[model samples]
Target chain A: MSEFWSDYTVRVVVFGSALIGAVSGALGCYAYLRRQSLIGDVVAHSSLLGIVSAFWGAFLLTGSGNKSLWVIIPGAIVAGLAALLLTRAVTGLTRIKEDAGLGVMLAIFFGTGMMLLRWLQRAQPPIPGRSSLDGYLFGMSAAMTSQDLWMIGLIGAAAVITMLLFWSRLKILTFDPEYAAGLGLPVRRLELLLLCLMVIGIVVGLQIAGVVLMISLLVAPAAAARQWTHHLGKMVGLASTIGAICAAGGALLSAVFSHLPTGPVIVALVTLAFVASVLCSPSRGLLFRRRFVVD
Target chain B: MDIAIETQQLTVAYGAQPALWNVNVEIPSLGITGIIGPNGAGKSTLLKAILGNVPRLSGHVTLHRTDEAGSAAIGYVPQRSAVDWDFPTTVFDLVMMGTYGRLRWFQRPGKREREQTRQALQQVHMEEFADRQIGELSGGQQQRVFLARAFVQRASIYLMDEPFAGVDAKTENMLIEILHQLRDEGNTIVLVHHDLTTVKDYFDHVVLLNRKLVACGTTPQTFTAENIELAYGVAGKQLLSRIS
Candidate 1:
């Protein structure tokens, strides 16, 4: 217990997770408003392919198999954006709807990523950071370094700043896209900006929560916050706060219990918050609405 | 009479099917103009084409007031069902959005804008609901809120799509009064209206449409049984009989 409190690695991991949680949660509000929650899941899953591709590329370029965050983050962003574009193209060009397009993209990209990871394992000599590659699936926060924390902080700051700067435009775009376009706003460009932010948020979460559980970090906090407030500004603020708390708490609980994995623990905490919000939030909550019966 | 809007062979399509075909019409300035048609008659499509909301297959719409800033000359009230009512926003905040077009990028609504929003809400009799969440309002109140938003824009030309649909009698009367006030103040108001009975009473000028222009003239001159029949097919004769 004393060692856990003093360990710098634990401190870095917790901070990194908190930053990842806050950024994803805040950006997730727009996705939720746009009814594109599944897009977050799609982006997270597709980023796995990006990670493996980055590793392979690094191996090919340097003749050394080092999993650098520099290469991995950019690769994840590219893959996430590509997946989004593919989904858009499928929906726009074909008769398929957006949900079906998202489903197709999610399955194909994740399946391809898994195949690439397995092939990399069998095809190459034991890479230096190859063992930790599995960590990107389920996450290994215990192994996060100060460098990971810096990367998370940089990406998180960028996302938050961009959201603040374009707050009104994004709000209008999310709530009434057609009206925004009619008002002479560059609706397509604003949408692209939001998608880029979502991709960046997902990329930042990859090392902390991993592909499988990252969507929960992106969506759950916003969902929970939405129950408590009807104002978008308040919703974004509350979601960021909730996300930071949940991530830090989960990291601490996982630290206390060595058997519990950090990623799943964080996801469980977020789920609990969402459930509580659904059951107990005022005005809109199931229990409150039933008790009050006010329309 | 000055022409506020002129469409020159305006054609719009949804995929291969044309929504509006070769719509050539002139909307007079400084009065209430009704775009009356049946369902799927391109009434709404005409307004959208004028506003550049839909892609034009051919031709163009020219606004007479070329000196006005981009989109600032027009205020649009979309259909009630166009936006999600359950969106998380207050009445005041939504109304402030009307001022966005006049503002520079990254500039938020300020004191003057707030005052205008307040005045617009007052005009719609929605001042009391300023703080209320949009979803909490009744359907009539929601419609009034959208009107307030459009009013705050203060555009010279107003285009409304089914603004009276689903509203209470009181809201309808209030909206009609406001429209009369705007018209008297020399603003051009065009509405996509379905009720043929109110066309004569509500508007001075009318455009009868059925995917193409059936008639465009003063209401008394254009709102005739023959043109109504042309726009609404055989059923319009019966409707006209009922109206007369």
Candidate 2:
């Protein structure tokens, strides 16, 4: 255990997971409050297509396909935003509800992503990044390098700072969008900003939590924090802390165990935290054994 | 009287069906104006369209605010059901949002903002509930909270959608009093109102609508049985006997 702790690779993996968790957790609060919790799932799943499209674009442009995190992050963002905006547009312009539209986009995007992934794997010359491509699906945190850590740190910090700068508008927009617009805040642009931020947060974390398990890390911490506080400020602060703890702890466990997967471990810890919060939270818990039922 | 708002060929549609069409009316400044109509008469849709809450298929709404900075202070109180009540925010924080219009980019609520929020809450008699979560308030209290938010805006023009719905008589009277106070201060107040019995008493000017403008003038002149019948069609026949 001490030997692994001393290993630079393990440290990077753990720190990277923590950064992803905190950003996803804080941003997830607005989605949770707005009842758009499933958006993260949609974005994460749709980003698979983005990752493949990006790799193909690189392969087509240059002889070598660059599977670099920077290239794929933008690609994932584009795909994720497209999916969300398309869903909103369909919901607004037609009779299709947002949930149905999201579901449809998820299937089409992910289906195309899988098909592209298969084509990449079967390429005669063999794509250089093809072997490690599966890492984006279920994550390969064990392959973390110092470079990955830097990307996560810089991207995560920018997302957090953006949220802070737009704090009041975002809060009003989340709670009452119509009133916010009447207050003269640009509602559509603000909504787009939030969508872009959500996409960025999800895309950045793909390498740490993977597409399949990313939504859990995004939602669980915020959901759990909600049960403990009635204030948005406290809820956000607590959610970030909870997310960081569960992520770091899960990453450490994955590092110690030779065969355990990093994404699933981190996901399970956050889920457990949510369950505990629901059952035992003193203010708004499921428990009926309150020391005093003031009501 | 000066005109605070005028609609020229204002039309709005939801998909293929038009919610409102060819709505042309002038809302008088410095008084209470009632947008009286039945269900699906585009009463709420009219307010929403004017505020750009709903997309307009065509036409325009001209606001003849005495001042542009004052125009930016257009305060709106949406219906109780418009927003999620269970959002994690206290009454103080929610009411403080009214000052957001005046805040510059990257600025936050400061001591001045806090004091304004407190004063607004006091005006609406919601100061006691400042610390409570929004969802914890009663329906009427929630309405007052929304009103406090608008009051904090200190605007020259106020647009409210059904402020009296689902509230007790006491709350209704209090809300009426606030409207009277705002009106006396030379602020133009427009409300999407349904109750015919209170229409004449509550508003100085009224716009009777049914997808189109049935009547638009002073309440005593335009809010008549004949116009009500035209706006509501056959259903309005039943109301004519009750209101008259």
Candidate 3:
């Protein structure tokens, strides 16, 4: 057990997962409240394209496959933001609703990302970091370094600070956007910022839970937290804590076990938490709700 | 003869269809004005257009507020259906949103704001339900909570969309009494009102719409059966005849 503390990779992976989990879980409440939970999933899936693009861009720029955190983080952010922008533009300008638009964009971006990753794998010259590309799909927490931890910490801090600064306006905007506008608040800008924050949340955790399962870390904790609290502040706080615990617990389990995958482990723990919250919550739980129906 | 708000050649459309077409009217200062129209007659559209919630295809809504120097402080009570009632928030927190507009972009609601929110809840008789989650409230209580949200804001003009819909008689009377009190407190209140029988009792001025201005004047003078018929088509005759 002492060896677990000494292994640098394990420490990095566990801490990184906890940081990413807390940030995404906190920010995920906005998407959940706005009834746009799918957008977070879409943004996370769309980030795969950004991850591949960063590899390509880095390989072309320096004549070597620079699959570092610096190159990848910005690439993921741009792609996530692009996906959100395209969805917004399509929904705004055309008769296509947001659901249809997001689905189409998700397919296009994810398909392209999958193809690019294959191409990198089959490259004749053998891309230097091409072997590590698949780690982003299911998240290779074992491969995480102190540098990756630093990047996650920086982005997570940015997200938490921005959330604190715009807390009230965001609450109003999430609960009632029309009312926000009627009060002469800049509704469009605040909404755009909210989506941008979602992108930040997704981007920070892209490598920890990977593109495919990272969304669960955002969603499950929030859904669980909602069943337990009626206040927005408490919900967000509880969600963040739940996310951190699930992720850290998953990291510990994967570390102790020989063959377990980190991302799916974290996601599974969060899902279990969600189910427990649904069944056992004191006030809004399924069990409690049925009992109070006669009154 | 003071006009608090005036719309000139206002036109709005959703997709190919026009919701409001070439609407022109003046809302008088410091009185309760009822914007009366049949279902889909653009009554709600007019308020949204005036508040700039939706895009105006073309036209101008000019606000004439002598009290405030900058943009007029406008409080809005959108239809109950406008917001998600099951949202995770308490009555107090929702009402606290009303004071958010008065602060700077990044400023949080302080102690004074909380005091004002409590007062607003007290005024609406929702002070006791401050901690209750919004979804737990009845329809009438929800309406009252919405009213409290709007009332927390100190604005010169209040635009309410169907504050009387789906509410019981006791709640309706309380809302009317509150509206009259707000008008008496020197604020211009405009409502997109239904219920033809109560038009005379509730509103002092009336603006009837049928995708265009049918007639707008004093309730006693212009809220006649003919104007009601002009906007509501054949259904007006049966409804108004019963009331008269």
Candidate 4:
């Protein structure tokens, strides 16, 4: 146990996961308020396509099979942004609602990604490090290197700093976009900036929780924090704290158990927090409301 | 009379269907103007069009500003149903949003803005509820909160959508008093009002609309039975009789 605590890899995994959690949780407050909670999932899932595409493209161009994080991160960003724009276009140009558009994109992008991954596996000249692509799906905290941690920290800090700097405009944008427009705010530009931040948050989170479980990291902490606070700033702060704690705890537990995957464990912890918050929060909780009958 | 807002052959549409068509009207400055129309008569659409909330299919709207260096020339109170009141924010924070227009990007509200917000809340009799969550307010209180938000903008022109839709008598009276006070201070107040009963009592000028401008004149001249009938059909006469 002491050796586990002293191990450098375990320390990096824990710190990296916690940083990803805090960033995603804070940004998730806006997603939750905008009722676009599924957007994170959409971006995360679509990033898989970016990962596989970057791997294939890099190999084809350089005649090398080495899967570089540098190549994959940009690819994921491009794919995530593409998915976001396509979803917006589908919703804006057609009668299809935003939710339905997101669902369609999620399925198409994820399906194409899965097929590409399968083809890569079956290719005659097998990619040497093709298995690393799977890490972007379910995450491998145990395999995280110093380079991956630095990338995660850099992206996470950028997302959190941008959010803090534009806090007021973003708050109004999330609350009432029409009113924001009336005030002569650059509503479209502000919205695009927010989606760009979400893309950053989701991309960074993809390394720790992976695509399938990343949405939980984005949503659960914010959902739990919301039940406890009636102020947006406080809610966001609380969500970050909750996210960091859950991520660190999950990382430690997974490190100790050896058999438990860190991503699912972190997701489960956040879900538990959400349930506890919903049931026990002072003003809005089910138990409190049931007992006190706040009108 | 000085015209505060002028729309020239303004047309707005929702997809293929036109909401406001070839509407030309000038709102007089320093008066309470009531925009009265039947359901689906584009009353709210006219206000939205003027505020640039909705896309104008063609034509233009011009706000004649007496002062060039004000925070914002226009303040808007959207329909109560248009907002999610359950959003996590205090009444104070919501009102402070009015000051955001004047603030530069990334600039937080400071002492002056906070003071203005407090005064605005006091003006609307919502000072006590400033710290309360928006969702905790009654329907009338929520409307008052929105009004305070608009009030804090200190804009020369105020556009409100259905300020008296579902409020209690007390809140209605409070809102009417504030509107009168604002008008007396030489601010133009345009309200998309549904109640014909309060037109004579509430507005100095009335813009009667039915997809287009039916009448735009003083309440006595524009709120006539003939124009009301044109705007609201035969039921307009019945409503006028009941109100008169």
Specify the poorest-scoring 10-residue window by lDDT in model 2 chain A: A286-295
Tell me the spans in candidate 1 whose CA falls farther than 4 Å from its real position.
Answer: A290-295, B66-73
> Which CAPRI tier for candidate 3?
medium
Model 2 spans with C-alpha error above 4 angstroms: A89-95, A289-295, B66-71
Candidate 1 colliding pairs, count: 0
Candidate 2, residues A89-181, lDDT tens digits: the string is 889888998789999999988889989999898989887878788888987677777776787788889989999999999999998888887
Tens-place lDDT digits, model 3, residues A33-133 = 88777888888888889999998989998999876788899999988888889998998899998899999999988889999999989989898989989
Model 1's DockQ score: 0.52
Residue A38 Cα positional deviation in candidate 4, in Å, after optimal superposition: 2.2
lDDT tens per residue, model 1, A76-166: 9988889989998888777788888999999999999999998888774676677678888976677767776777788789889999988
- What is the Å distance of residue A263 in model 2 from its true position? 1.7
What TM-score does prediction 4 earn?
0.95
Candidate 1 per-residue C-alpha lDDT over B11-98 given as tens digits, one digit per residue, 9 for 90 to 100: 9988668999998999998789999988999988998888777889899999885325745447788898988877889989998888
DockQ for each of the predicted structures, in order? 0.52, 0.57, 0.63, 0.59
Q: Score chain B of each candidate by TM-score.
A: 0.97, 0.97, 0.97, 0.96
Candidate 2 global lDDT: 0.87
Q: Candidate 1 — which pairs collide?
A: none
Q: Candidate 4 lDDT, tens digit per residue, B15-98?
A: 678999899999999799999899998999998888787889899999886434553447889899988888999999999998
lDDT of 2 at A74: 81
**lDDT: worst 10-residue window of model 3 chain A:** A286-295
**Candidate order (lDDT):** 3, 2, 4, 1
TM-score of each: 0.94, 0.96, 0.97, 0.95
True contacts kept of each: 0.42, 0.65, 0.65, 0.55
- lDDT tens digits, residue span B25-45, model 2: 999887899998889989999
The DockQ leader among the candidates is 3
